[model samples]
Target: MTTAYCFDLDGTLTRQELLPLIASSVGLEDEISVLTEATISGVLPFDKSFKLRVRLLRDAKLDWIHAALSEQVEFDRHILDFIASRPEQCFVVTGNLDIWVKPVLDRLGIQSFTSTARLDDGRLDGIAHILHKGDAVSSLRDRFERIIAVGDGMNDVPMFEAADWRIAFGGTHSPNRLLVKLSDFVINDGNALCRLLNML
Candidate 1:
């Protein structure tokens, strides 16, 4: 059936949010948290907030940022195993910068759709592109007959709208209220989420 699975990176696949972890490398975790909360609450738009946060942390050493993310982020084991079993059908669709989350993506060993980072001399210069999750889903239409999306936040609304099926996952926390409203299924446990994916 050429089914594709699209997963949100932060909080959905990984137990910790990547941006705050990256920000911590520069002692800006508190600042990043404010923007993250505002975005999640719909007070700040994802694009604007993402850019501001990126600007705030752009000067942090790339090696240190990568090391922190690799050390601090934890993935949901059940879901990680599920993707590992069928890596070809899975994609990480995230608004996070490609360079910042490289470690996580490498661990999953799956295709990914992420915001692009501008680089100058091996340093993070700025954001080159901000990915809209809906576009990521649309880009997959030609390749997959059916797409199933999993996420847990307000930022994921566009992705949910574009997918054939939406699952609001809360393995780390409660699924966002609006996201739950848009989802075909709401699951709070990692193992149960894998079971539902198998059934689908």
Candidate 2:
């Protein structure tokens, strides 16, 4: 059976979250982080929090945002290398907007499923749709025999539910408590994460 690995982008695959980095680029990090924290803690819905954060960052220059991400974001080398060995078998599943995260995803050279952004005159408009991560995993069912998911947020609950193997990673910090309860394994080190991915 063919197995596919789905990874969450923020805090799981990367050492930091993307939205805050983008917000920091435009000097709105503190404002955006309030909404980001609420969403992750389940105080706000993912779609609503995402839209609000996007609106707050609407004026941010794409070039500046890209530069900030490139400068501050660091991928877990061990996980990055593991996926690099078989890019086709991996997918990045994130609630981040496609436009905002394109550069990072391109750098990884892997397939991804993310929220779509509505654009107007080459500028940010609004969200076209918010991705339900579980649906992304379900869509992969036809192609892969077993699917493994790794993430660290409440938003990742759906993905964990949809996947055959679930891992809650704490490389950046402690994973969401609920996600830990749902996970088959909890890995915190990059090398250990890579080994778990290999075993799955």
The segments of candidate 2 whose C-alpha lies over 4 angstroms from its true place after superposition are none
What is the Å distance of residue 38 in model 1 from its true position? 1.4
Provide C-alpha RMSD values for all models, in order.
0.9, 0.9
lDDT of 2 by residue, 1-200 (tens): 79999999999999998899999998998989898788777788888888789889998999999999888889998998999899999999999999999889989999999999899999988889899999999999999999999999889999999999999999887888889999999989989989877776
Candidate 1 structure quality by residue, lDDT tens digits, 16-66? 888898988889989999998888767888999999999899899889988
Candidate 2 structure, TM-score to reference: 0.97
Return the clash pairs for model 2, or none.
none
